[model samples]
Structure formats: C-alpha cells, structure tokens
Target chain A: MVPVEYYVGLSAILFTIGTLGVLTRRNAIIIFMSIELMLNSANLLFVAFARTFEALSGQIFVFFVMTVAAAEVAVGLALIVAVFRTKDTINIDEVSSLRG
Target chain B: MAPVNLNDLLTILPAVFIVVWACVLLLVDAFAGALGKRLTPWLTALGLVVALVLDVSAAGVQASAFNGMLEVDGFSHAINVLVLGAGLLSFFVSYDYLNRQGIAKGEYYILMLFSISGMMLMGAAADLIVVFLAVELLSIPLYILAAFAQPEPKSEEAGLKYFLLGAFAGGFLLYGVALVYGATASTRLSEIVAAVAAGLENPIFLLLGAALILIGLGFKVAAVPFHMWTPDVYEGAPSSVTAFMAVGAKVGGFAALLRVFIVAFPSLGVDLAPVLTGVVAATLIVGNVAAIAQRNIKRLLAYSSISHAGFILMAIVPYADDAVHRDTAAAALFYLLAFALTSFGAWAVVMTLERAEGKGLELSDYAGLFRKYPALALAMLVFMLSFAGVPPTLGFAGKFFLFRAVLEGGYVGLAVLGVLTSLVSAYYYLRVVVIMFMEEGKPQAAGSPLLNLTTGLTALGTVGLFFFSQPLLDWATNALLRLF
Candidate 1:
C-alpha cells in the first residue's frame, strides 16, 4: 500500500496549481474550472485521510463537499452567463465597469 | 449510529423555520406571478417576524442537536436576534429600492430569506461540515443575489467577481476542515476539543488549518488583504442588496469563526494571536487610509465597512485567551448591532437619493442636502457620526466595549491601532456630513414613507441605544456559549 504522505503531497501540489490557475487565468470559465480543481484536491485529501484513519466521517464530508461544490458551480455558471449577457464577454479583463 | 431524534429538530426550530419559510416563498412566487412581486416582501417580513417570535420564545433554553452538529445557546440566540433583525430591516429598505430599480421580482425576497437561513445556521453550527455547508449556503444565495440585476454590466461583474473570490475562499475553508478532521479524526467541535486536549497527533496541520479557515472567513467579513472585491462588488450590486450584504454576510462569518476557533483550537492560542494581530492591524490601516481617497459614496462605505470589520476583529484577536472569548463575543455582537442600525439608516438615505441609472452615487451628489431635506440629511449625519464611533451614538458604546475587550485580551498595540484608525475614519465620515449640510448644490431626495420610516427608526436606535447600552451588553454577556 502507498504511503499517505504521497497523497498529501499530491493534493497539496494540485491545490497550488489550481490556485495559480485562478490567479493567472483571465477567462471566467477557466477560473471556474480552477476552483473545481482546488475543491477536488481537498476531496482527495479527505478520502486519503479517511482511509488512513479507517473512519467514514472524512469520506462523509467529501460527499458534502462534492454536493456543495456542484451547487456552487450551478450558481457560478449562471453568474458567468449574466456577465456575458451584459458585456458580451466572459474575460475578467472585460468585466471591469465598476473598478476603482 | 446517527443521532436521529425529535430533540434535534426542536433545538434548531428557528433556523428550520427560516428555511421552510423560504421554500414556501419560492412556491408562492411560482404561482402568484405579478401579485407575488407586491406580496412577497410583506410575507418575507412576516416570516422573519415569526422566526423572531420562535427565537424569542425558545429563549432560556439550550440544547445540542444532530449529535453535536448544532449548538443552541445564549450566543446563538443573540446572533439570531441580530441576523433576523437585519433581515427585517433590509426587507423594509429593499422593497422600495427594488421597485424603483424595476427589478422587483418575488425571487428577491425568497433569496434573502434563504440567505438569512444560512446565516442563522452559521451562528449555531457546531461541526466542521456544517460550517462548510453554512458558509456555502449563505454565500451561494448572495452570489446569485449580487447578480440579481442581470444584464446590468456592473451588477453581473460584481456577481462574477464575488463568485470567483468566494469560491476560491471556500476551497481553502474546505481544505482547512479536512486537515482539522484528519488531525482530530472528527468534525464535531466537542470531539475536536477533546482531541486537542489529549494532544494533537499533528499540530502543524491544525495550525495551517486554522490559518486557512481564517483566510476563508476573513474574505467574507471584508478584512484587508482579502478585501480586493469589496469596493467593486458594493459599487455594482443594487444599493438595497449592498445594505443587506454589508451587515448580514459578515456577522455569520464572524459568528462561525468565533465558534470554531474558540471551541476547537483555543489550545493553539499562542500561534493564533500573533496572526490575528497582523490581520487586525492591516485591516485597520488599509481600510481607513484607503477610504480617504474614494470618490464614489458606495466605495467609501465599502471601505468604512472594511474598517469596522477590523474593529470587530479586535474582539477575536485574543480568542485563545481564557474567559476573554466570551467578553469578546459579546463586544462583537454589540458592535454588529450598532453597525447594522447605523448602516441600515445610511443606506436608506443613499437609496432615497439614488436615481435610476446610478445617477446619485458620487460624493458630490450629497451637496446641499440639509437645505433641501433636513430630516434625511440629519439622519445621514447621525449615521456618519455613529460609524466614526463618535459620542451620543450606539457606535460609541460599541467601540468602547470592543476596545475594552481587546485591552482585556492583552492586545495593547492593536487597541492603539484601532483607536488611530477610528480617528482617520472620522475624516471621511465627517466629510460626507459636511457636504450634506455645509456645502451648496440642488439636491433632491426621493421621499418614500417606508424608507423615511426606516431611516428615522434606525437613527433613533443608533442614538437612543447608546444610553441603554449597558443592558444590551449585559444581555450579550449573559449569552454564554455552550462550549469550553
């Protein structure tokens, strides 16, 4: 069996990459996907930890995280559509009418 | 085995009622059509009142529900009062503002009720999973609500920015929860505390988890460094939603932050205090100094809101200190009440003066307001003073209590910084007051009875509540949290 440390390191790396994508990407859809990646990294950690401890609670929380992440995506995509409707673009650079 | 019993439902009756009422309002909107637009606000107000009734009637009762997932105690009770009162007041202000904006839909009020339900859950949530869910439950509605003025570029942009940042923050919060669960092998606060007492298997993970959780929550409360989205979002969202979001959202975030940190990680006080100190300091400096340069009134108020979040954060800075957490919680609650009243009044005045197409949003728009409308201008003056924490207002009393809590928590330097920022804030807060009364221009305020009444009542509350402040503080003091 593989060590849990590997899973932890892998998830951390995934989380960092996701964060970088969110910070660097200009497209709203890409940012949305980056958030999904970050959330899934968290899910991987939860499952790995659950297996390590022989506990179902961590796995249960993963289910909650997945369900809520899905809900957030629904609302987030709707917001992206709203932005597109108003500005005719989904680029974060273009959605800057209210900036300081 | 899951702890499924009637007692669990009974303990969370008020929150459950709020969700039930929201779902019912959705159905009401579906069938009632145009009539629902006119009817929903009243029904929403009625639902909040009933929840308030349920909250009050359930007073002096304490219980843990869902096998320690929900904690109903004095602290949660006080939070219920604050959140519901904010919901009711926001409803009063929103009805006219939405109608004026020509976006008066039934779903608006329904969405608010659902968000308010999430807030209520945050105050009472005792498990990590519940906190994660509560944060999303509160936020998802707001992400939609911020963009409620769809096809308005500013509103959609605000919505999208808020969604992206809020979702980014949620990832951190969930990971934090996961780390905490991994360390303690439980998501429940009671068990987590027990695990901490027995000694954490991995203390580094616990510390990292707390810091990440703080980042996630700090975003919601509009703390500095995490506050990049505040001005844009506040400027773009409809004025009424901004009013509600300002007071309603962070109170839940702070509530959950206080509960989780105070209960689960009090043992990590040495590590947490310095971090909180840095956040409080930066939030104060940035929030105050930045407000001085704002040209738009909405952005000005957004910075003011950020600074107030800093002042409230002072109460949480010394969270790891024994027994002081309770005092700090009370102090924060009182400050939140003061903020809600003052901002509700201020925003009502803003909404009254606001013309369609965002015409009256500039700082210059308030010129000669006292000459045209004395009462409204005077109310604005009162609100500005309260926000500046000046004398003869609820804000003064709030600042006094919160500062004392900080001093008690032994954060002397942070307390000094808080005072200095309040001084800096007075300049901008008073600048508006000056423009309203002393300057010269033709200013017309759209006078509506409901908004006028809201402004009048909140101004009175901001001033009058100051004299009777001790009793309010005592009430908050009496609200003992049902945790270690």
Candidate 2:
C-alpha cells in the first residue's frame, strides 16, 4: 500500500500546481479549474485523515464538500459563459476598464 | 443524539424558509418564462417579505440548532432584517434600472434571495464549516451578479476580480480552519473556546489560524490593504448591484466578522486586539485619504466604504471586559444599520440620474443638479450630509456612538483620529453637495424617473432615522448585552 506520506506529498504537489494556475493563468476558466484542483487536494487530505483516524465524520464532510464544490463549479462556469457571451472574449487582461 | 425540538427547528426556520422560497422562485421563473412572461422576481420579493416577517416575529428567542451548527439570537435576527431590507430595496431599484437597461431577468432576484438567505444563516452559524459554507453561498451569487450586466466590459472585469480575490481569500480561510481544527480538534466555536480555556501552552497555531481567518474576512469587508479591488468592482458593476453589494455584502461581512472574532476566538483577544487596532488605523487612513482624490462618484463611495470598515473595525477591538465589549458591539451594529440606509439611498440617487445609454453620472456631472430636480436634490442632500456626519442625521448619530464606544474603551487616540478623518471625509462628501448647489458646469439636464414607492420609502427611512436613533440604540445595546 502507498504510505500516508505519499498521499500527503501528492496533495502538496497538486496544491502548488493549483496555486501557480491561480497566480499566472489569464483565462478565467483555467483559474476556476485551479480552484477546483485546490479543493480536490483538500478533499484528498480529508480522506486521508479519515482513514488514518478511523472516523466517519471526516469522510462524510468530504462528501458534503464535494457536493458543494460541484455546485460551485456549475455556478462558476455559468458565470464565465455569461461573461464571455457579453465580451466575446475570455481574456482577463482585455477587461480592465474598471480600474481606479 | 436527541431529536430536534420545536425550538431547534424554529432557530433555523428563517433560513430554511428563505431557501425554499428561493428554489420555488427559481423553478417558477424557469417554467413561467417558458409559458409566458415570468412574475417570479415579484414573487421572490413577496416570499422574502414573509420570511422577514417570520424572522422578526421570532426575535429574542435564543437557541442553538442542528447540533450547534447554528445559533440564533436577537443579533442575528437584526442583521437578517437589515440584509433582507437591503434585498427588498435592491429589487425595487433594479426593477427600473434593469428594465431600462433591458436585462431584467427574474433569475437575478432569485440569486439575490439565495444570497440573502446565506447571509442570514451566516450571521447565526456557530461552526467553522458552516460559517465557510454560509460565506460561499452568499459570495457565489454575488460574483455572478457582479458580472450580470451583459455586454459591459467593466461588469465582466468586476465579477472576475471579485471572484479571483474572493476565492483566494476563501482558500486562506479554509486553510486557517484546517490548522485551527488540527490544533483544537474541533470546529465548533464552543468546543474551540473550551479547548483554549483548557489552556494550550503555546498557541502559535491558533494565532496563525486566526490571522489567516482575519485576512480572509478583511478582504470580504474591503478593509484597507485587502481593499484594492473595492473601487474598481464598485465602479464597474451595475449601480443597483453596487448598492446591493455596498450595503448587503458589508452587513453580511460584519456579521461574520463579529461572530468569528468576538465569539469563536474570544480567548485570543488579548493578543489579537492590538493587531486589529493597527488594522483599523490603516483602514481609516487609507480609505479616507484615497477617497479625497477620486473623480468617479462610485469609486469615491467605494473608498468611503473602506473607511466605514475602519469604524466598524474599531468596534471589534476586544474590550478590557464584557461591558465594554457589549457597548462597542452595539455601536458597531447600529452604525452598520445607519450606514446601510444612507449608502443605499446615495446609490439610489446615482441610479436615478443614470441616462438612457447609461453613460452619465460623474462627479462633474452633478454640477447644478439642484436647479433641475429639487426633490431629488433634497434627497441627495440628506444622503451627503449624513455621510459627512452632519448633525441630526443618522450618520452623525452613528459617529457619535462609535466615538463614545472608543472613548469608553480607552482608545482615546483612535477616537481622535476617527474625528480627524471625519473632518477630512467632509471635504469629499461636501464636494457632492457643493456640486449640486453651487457649481455651474451644467450636466446635460434630464428628468429623474420620479422616485418609486420603494425608493421614496428608503429615502424617507434614512431621513427619519434621527428620530428613531434612541430606540434603535437601545435594542442594539440589549442584543449585544446577550452576546457576551
């Protein structure tokens, strides 16, 4: 079996990738996907904790978090579509008329 | 586990009721629009009104519900009313603005209902996960609404900026929760308090967690340093959305801020209070000084909001004892209510002046406005004067109470700075008034859509508030007395 450290390491790596996406990606969709990745990493950690602690609540929480994440993805994607339909481009840099 | 009691169910009844109402409105709008033109927004407003009535009727009934995931009290009830009232006003203001702009979709109102429901629940949430979830529920819809102004590049930018920064803040908050959970082994505020009381020798993890959480919420409330997004977002979003966000979102943010800092981590106040005081100082200084230079009216109001966050932050400073805490909390709560009314009215006036292509409304554009629209001018006067803390207005009353609370808490220096900033703020606030009454650089004159019943009521409520300050102050004090 893969050790707990392996799972932890994977989560850390995935989280870092998500963070990089958030910081560098100009595409709103990519940024959203990055958030999903970060959330999934958290879920992975939660599952590992549940397994290690022999607790059901942590796993249950993971399930609830997954449900919420799905809802967030749906809403976020819908917003992106609306934004794109308005501007005809998904370029984040192009939409800077609101600056102070 | 014990079975749910009537009191337990009653504790969360408003949230449940509003959620159901939102879902029903959404469904009805979907099918109704397919059949004919949907009347779901009006229906949603009616449903919120009913839920608000239920919330009011249940006032003063304090109870913990759903195994302590939620806690309902007069404080939460009051905030709920403010948020719902904001929703109601937003609906009325949007009715004209959206139709005129040709984007009056029923889903917007449903989204607002969902958001307000989340905000109501957030104020009452006692568990960390529940608080985070409540925040998300409130925020997600707002992100959409921020971008909902179709074909407007600025709207899209506002939504994206808010979403990105907001999501980043959320991550910090979540990580903080994780660390806190790891440290205390529980996410419930009661359990965390007990654990802290039980005395961990080194509270580094707890302190770090609180700091992260504070940063997260500081962003939400648009406190300075995390407030870079506020002006742009406010300026770009539709005026009604800006008004809704300006008042409703801040109310929700303050409610969460009060609960988290005052309740969950009460034990850490000794270490945290001074840090927060510094933040308050910075927020006030930055918000006010930046506002003085703004040419765009919306951006100016955004900076004004940041300064108000400073005043509210002053209220969050942990007291030397419970009495001082109660006093300051009451001041903050009352100030928030007063701020909501005046700010919304100010934006309503701005919305009223919006042109057909929706391109008018700038600081210079307000020149000699009083000559054209006297009633609108008078209403605008009330909003401006109150914002400047002129006497016999709710804004002045709010400032008085806040300064009194600061003095009582021995923050004499902070109170002095607050007064000084108030004086500085007068320059910008009075600039609006002067532009209206004195300046001759004429804005291409146009007729204001006569104030509808709801906007009229909102303006009246703000103006009439000086008469009601005493009773409102009493209720706020009483509610806060229960908190500590």
Candidate 3:
C-alpha cells in the first residue's frame, strides 16, 4: 500500500502552492482558483488520514467539503461577474477604490 | 449511527425553523412580486420572532442531540437570542435605508435569516463537520449581501474580496479539522477532548491544527494581521448590511471560537495561551491605531469593532486555566452583549445620517448633527461613550469584567495593555461625538422613525443595562458549555 506520509507530503505541497498563489495573484479568477486548490489539498489530507486511521468520519467530512466548495464556486463566480460588470476589470489592484 | 429521534429534532428546533421558514419565504417572494417584496421583511421579522421565542422556551432545557452533533445549552440559547435579535433589528434599521436606496427586495431578508440560522447552529455545534457547515452557511449569504448594492463597483469589490478571503480561510479551517481528526481519530469535539486527555496519536498535528483554526476564526472576527479585508468590506457594503454583519457575524465567530478551543481543545490551552495573548495584543494595537487614520465612518467603526474583538479575546486567552474559564466565558458573553447594543445604536445613527447614494459617510459629514437633532446627538453620545468604555455605560462594565477575569488568570501584562489600548481607543470613538456636537456642518438625516426607535432603544439598553443588568449578568455567568 502507498504510505500515508506520501499523501500528507503531496497535500502539504499543494496547500503551500495554493497559499502562495492567493497571496501573489492579482486576477480575481486566479485567486479564486487558488482558493479551490487549497480546499482540494485539505480534501486530499482528509482522505489520506481517513485511510491511515481506518475511520469513515474523515471520508464523510470530505463529502461535505466538496459540497461546500461547489456552493462557493457558484457564489464566488457570481461575485466576480458582479465586480466585472461594475469595474470592467477583474484585477484585484484595479478594484481598489475603498482603500485608506 | 443512531437513528434520528424527536428529541434530536427539538434540540435544533430554532435553526431548523429558520431554514424551513426561509425556504417558505423564498416561495412566498417568488410567486408574489411587489406584494412579496413588501411582505418579505415583515414575514422575516415574524419568522425570526418565532425562532427567538422558541429559543427562549428551550432556555432551561439541555441535551446532546443528533447523537452528539448538536448541543442545547445556555450558551447556544444566549447566542440564538443575540443573533436573532440582531437580525430583527437589522430589519428595522434597514427598512427605510433599503427602500431609500431602491434596493428593497425579498432576497435581503431571506439571506439574513439563513445567516442567523447558521450562527445559531454555530453556538450549538458539538462536531467539527457541523461547525464547518455553519460557517459556510453564515458567510455565503453575507458575501452576497455585501454586494447587494451592485453594479455599484465598491459593493461588488467588497463582495469579491470578502469571498476570496473567506474562502481562503475556510481552506485553512478545513485543513485544521483534517489534521486534528488525523491526530485523534475523531471529529466530535467532546470525543476529541477525551482523546486528548487519554493521549493523542500525535500532539504536533493537534497544535498545528489549532493554530490554523485560530487563523480562520481571526479573519472572521477581523482581528489584526487577518483583518486586511475588513475595512474595505465594511466601507463598501450597504450600511444596513454592514451593521447587521458587524453584530451577527462576530457573535457567531466568537461563539465557535469559545466552544471549539475551550470546550474541545482545553488540553492544549497551556500551550496556546501565549499565542492567543499575542493575537489579543496586536489586534488591540493595530485595530485602534489604524482607526485614527480613517476618514470614512464605516471603516473607523470596522477598526473599532476589531479592537472590541481584542478585549473579548483577553477573556478568551485566559481560558486555559480551569479556575478562570467560567469567569472569562461570562466576561466574554457580557462584552458581546455590550458590543451588540452599542454597535447597533451607533450604526443606527450612522444609517440615519447617511444621504442618498452613500454620500454622507465621511467623518466630516457628522459635523453639526447636534444642531438639528439634539435627542439623536445625545443618543449617539451614549453610544460613543459606551464604545469608549466610559463609566455609567455597558462598555465599561464589559471591559471591567473582561480585565478582571484576565488578571485573575495571571495575564497581568495583557490586562494592563488592554487598559492602555482602551485609552487609545477612546480618542477615535470620541472623535465622532466631537464632530456631532462641537463642529459645524449641515448634516442631512433620513430621520426614519424606525431608525429613531432602534437608536433610542439600543441607547437606553446600553446605559440602563449597565446599571440594571444584574439578572442578565447572572444569566451570562450561567451560560457555560458544560455538555460533556
């Protein structure tokens, strides 16, 4: 069987990349995609740990995470569209009128 | 899994009622058009009032329902009352503003009901899965509400920014849950604590998980370092939505933080205490210091709200010591009540002063408000004093209890810093009072009777509750999470 550590290592790398993308990306769409990546990484961790511990609860948690992520995609994309309609730009920097 | 029972259903009755009512309200709005639009707010109020009544009826009852998924206790009951009350008041303050802005719709109240139900569930959630679901339920509606003024770019940007940041934090929270589950082989909070007491498969994972969870919640409450999106979101969202979000969201976030950390992870308290203390300190310094620079009233209040989060954290940071947990919990709850009353009153005043198209939001616009409306100004003065923790106000009582609790827990330095920061916070809070009474500028106000009623009632509660809140204080004291 593939080792659980390998799964953890993969998820950790993906999570780090996702975090970096969210911090650095300027495009609203890209930032949102990064957030999805981060959520999937956690899902990967949950599945890995569930297998390692032989528990159904962790696996069940992943289903809820997937459901939430789908709902988020619906809202997040709608928001991006709303921003684009008004500002005509999806760049986070250009959307900056309310800043101090 | 145990089969669902009648008792389990009763345990989560308030939240269930809200969800069911929201669905029914959606159908009512969809078929009814303008009639539905007008009926929505009243119906929403009716539904919330029903839930509030049901919640209070369950006050003396306690149970672990849904086979340990939901908890019915004083803690949950208090949170239900707070969030429901905030939701209902938001409607009152919002009624005129929403119509005036020409954005009055059935959806607004529906979204709020969904969010309130989520918050109520947050207080009662005894399992991690439920907590995660509750957070999403509360937040998604708010993201949409923040942008409800769109095609106004500011509102849309606020919605998008809040969504991005909130989704990112949810990732962290999910990872934290996964890690904690990995360490303990359980997702139930009560079971997690039991496992920790017995010993964990890995302690490192637990610590890391808790830290990540803290980061997620910190963002929700707008604590410093995690608060980058707060000012812009608060400034951009419609004023009525901002007011509701400010009170309701904080109540839910803090409720979960207390239950998850203090109830589920008490074993890690000694280790997490220093970290929480540092967060409290930074939140106080940064939240207050940044507010001094804000010209926009909404952004300033956002920062003030953050600093209040810090003072409440002072009580929470000391929960590691068992001897002090009850006192700290009570302090935190009382402070939340103070913040809710004072915050709603101040926002009602802000809403009153706001001109069409969000023009009258600058701090300078508040000048000369006292000349036209003496009663309104005095009520605003009471709100400002309460927020500044001045004597003969609820804010003072809240702070006194919080600091005393922290001091007893041996965090003398944090308590002292809390005091110093209160002095610093007073400068900015009082700035509004000065602008209203002393300065000169013609500030137009909507002067809606509903708005005035909100301001008067909350203002009265702020000062009167301070002096005559012994029974309420006793209730807060008894509102502990002892379900295990």
Candidate 4:
C-alpha cells in the first residue's frame, strides 16, 4: 500500500551508498560490492517504474539486467580471486600497475 | 499475430543466422569431444564468412523486422559487414595466437560470435531498450574474453576492471532510458521522435536522458573523462583481444552512438551542441597529449583510440545541431573502416612480436626491428603512418573526409583542432617508427622470424586498401545515401 515515492527513496538511498562506497573503499572486493549495489538500485527502480506504469517491458528489462549482473559478478569475483592470488592484495590502491 | 513470409524471414536472417551459428558452436563445444575444442574456430570463421555474405546480400533492402525492434538500413548493413569481417579476422589471428598461448578452445570463438551478435543488434537497434540490451550483450562477453587467460594475473585484472566500468556505464544508460521513457511514454526511437515532433517540450528530462546516454556511450567509445580504463585494460588483456577490441567494439559503439543521437536526440541539438563541443575538444587534447608519455605500445594505442573517439564525436556535432547530414555520417563510417583496418594491422603486429611466454613488448624493444624483421617492420611502419594520418594512406583519406564533413557542417574550428591534434599525435606514432628504423637492436633480440600468416595477410590487406581506398569511399558514400 506504500506509494511509488517510497520505492524511489529506497533505490536512491541504495544508489547513494553505492556511490559513497565506490569513492571511499580501497578494497577491490568492496568496490565490486558497491557496483552490485548500484546495479541493484537500478533494478529496484526498474521494478518500481514497471509497477507504476503497468508495463511488462520494464520488468523484462530488469530480468535481463539481473542476468547480466550475475554473469558480471561471477566473472568479476573470479578475476579478483586470480589477481589477489598473484599479487597477494585485494586493495584497489595496490592494483596500480594498470593505472596511468 | 500474422504468420511470417520470406520478406519477414529475410529481414531477420542475418541476426538469426549468427545466433544459430553461435548456438551451434556452443552445443558442439558442450557435447562434441576434442574436435569441438580444436576445430570449432575454423568452423566459426566459416560461419561468419557465410553470415557476412548474407548480410551484404540483404543490404539496401530497408525493412523493419522483429516487430520493429530491429532495422536493416544501408548504414546498419555496412556496419554489419565491417563487424563480421573483423570477427572473422579475429578468429583467423586468434587461432594461431591461442594455439601458441595454449588457450585455444571452442568457447573463445563462441563468445566472440555472441558478442558480435550483440554488436549487430546494437547497430540495427531503433529502440532504447534494444540499445541497452545490445550494449550488455556486446560487453559481457568481452569482459570474459579479456580475462580468458585465467592463469594470467594481468588478464584477470583487465577483466575485472572492464567489468566494473562497463557495468557502471550500463547503469547510466539504463537510467537514461527510464527517464526518456518516463518523459515520452515510450522506449521506441520512432515513438520518441514522433512525440517530440508532436510538440513535447520537456527539455529537462530530454536533456538529462540524452546526457546520461552520451556518457554511457562515451565510456564505451573511450572518450576523455570516461576513458580512464582504456590504457590499463588494453595493456593487461591479451594482444589479440585488444586488437579485436580496438576495431570491432569501436565500430559497434560508434554505430550505435550515431543511430541514437541522429534518430532520437536530434531535436535536442540546441542544448546538446555546446556540451558535445566541450567533450570533443577535451577528448582530442587529452588523448593526444597523454599518449606521448606512454612507454608501453599497447597503452599508446589505447590513448590513440581515445583520440579517435574525439574525431568520431566530431561527426555527431553537425547532426546534433542540424539535420542528419548524410555526408558527415558517411565520412564517419569511412573513418571507422579506415581506423579499424589500420589499428587492427598495428595491433596484429604487436601480437606477432609478443612471444608465447606472454612477455610484453615495450617500445624500446623495437630497436633495430627493421634489420631483424624487415617485412614486419615495413608493415608496422605502414600501419603507424596511416594511424598518424600521413598522406595517401587510408587514415589520411579517412581524416580528410571526416574533417571535410565537419567543415561542410560548419564546424571549422573543431575541424582545425582535429587536424592540430593529429599533428601532435604524429610524434608518438612516429616514435615507434624511429625506434624500429633509426635505433639499433639490442643484442638479446632473437632472430625469430615474425611472418605470422593470418596477421601478415591482414596487414597486407590493410596496406593494399590504402591504395584502393577510393572504391571503399564510394561504397561508403553510397551506403550513407540511405540515411539522407
């Protein structure tokens, strides 16, 4: 029975948290978690809009986004594991070899 | 609700064929024995060759298929051919490189085909949702391929970095789509255009959506601010994947960008012009200037690619402020082809120089390359010169048309800046040539002859195209005529 604004507010909070984490966290894993949060925030917004507009297309899009996010998460975690094993650090600052 | 006819089937045939071929490869890999791992790349290459032929045959027959989610204009047709050609060549060079590196498998080609399918779809997409899906489709596989060398720490890092940034870009793009849909009550490009045409003046939502969409694509194209991931990921990924990325992925990104902006956001030109100008200007200056400091050849090309994105962004200007300038779009398409061929040739040479042990090729390592590998050195020289936009080469010809388009569109200052940046970029590109021709090879340089058949043939094709570029230009102009 909650209005649409509540969902919007929740997603906004999630998205802000993600942004803060991406900016502040130095650990690669935490940064990745922040990315997940960002994606989930969008997913939640999509569902809210789908409910508001009574459109199946928005929900369908959410499904596709979730699928891609899962694929990305699996592959991303695997990569972090590999990099950590090689360099012995999950800190984002330590992975500076690829940076400018 | 109606049954399909030959026309309907013909329209979707190219995408369907690629999808079927990809699925076939996937199944064969899962079920077939050693042959799947060993022989599927050749099979996949053959399938792409066939699909390219079919796609070319379907050109110039404009039709909407799959409920108008897909479009097959001459422009999309041209991009499809280029993408498929790039994929086939990637397959060709990959076979040798993968065999040498011990990562040869059916899955690699399967993922490549799937990625290409996404690209083709994106190029033909007329809807915002379709565009979003297509970007993800094109990108997800690339992330995996970037790290396909699971044992290599650099490869893993490349994959993770690309994934994080790509997903972030996707979120921006999706949010834009949602806002656009909220404003226009439709995700279809045609519907949005109609609504705008019908006097919808909600500039706030439109401008915000358009800017977000541009940011997302800017990331994909490696334009200035969003291009932070390019050098690192390009350096860390395998050379072949990097080569494929520097060509195929770029064509897809620009093709989608051109379509969306020209078709959807053309009405917003009054607001978009200044913002886009700033982006193009900064991208040109930053890409060229930063490239000068890179010691790694891969990172240099990455920065060069960002600069190329600036040049491509110039094509968006006239259309963003004016009508669909077919000449400018045509010129941009030609530049895309020229850039693809030249950059692929350059990266293929880089791949050839990298030994099986995965040792990176530093810029200084090319010292005395001319004496040791004369043909490769010459081929590499052609690619580097072409990229630097030197005379009579396709790169020069491409830039000539691109700047001419901008001039015709009345962006003379931007065109001049583009030329000036090209002059600055010549320094680093020619540095590779200097190290090859002017310097002496270090004594540790081995005599391993670098006559990689697939990559060498690709280089020859590229170098020869520079001589025969006029016909291609004519063809590109003809393909672009449809957009007008």
Per-residue accuracy of model 2 over B224-309 as CA lDDT, tens digit each: 78898899889888888899988888888888888777777987788988888899999999999999999888899999999999
lDDT of each: 0.90, 0.80, 0.89, 0.82
Please report, as a residue range, the 10-residue window in candidate 1 chain B with the lowest summed lDDT: B475-484
Candidate 3 chain B: minimum summed lDDT over ten consecutive residues — where? B475-484
Task: Quote the RMSD, in angstroms, for model 1.
Answer: 1.1
Cα lDDT of model 1 by residue, B220-313, tens digit: 9999899999999999899999999999998898899889988888888888888888999999999999999998999999999999999999
The interface RMSD values of the models, given in order, are 0.9, 2.0, 0.8, 2.0
Chain A TM-scores, per candidate, are: 0.96, 0.93, 0.97, 0.92
Q: Output the number of the DockQ-best candidate.
A: 3
Worst 10 residues of 2 chain B by lDDT: B445-454
Clashing pairs in 3: none
DockQ value of candidate 4: 0.54
On a 0 to 1 TM-score scale, where does candidate 3 land against the true structure? 0.99
Model 4, global lDDT = 0.82
lDDT by residue for model 2 over A1-100, one digit each (tens)?
A: 6666677578668877987998899898888888788777767766665665566655676676777777777767776777788777677777566656
**Model 4 stretches with alpha carbons more than 4 Å out:** A1-13, A47-54, B1-10, B321-324, B356-360, B442-451, B454-456
Chain B only, TM-score of each candidate: 0.98, 0.96, 0.98, 0.95
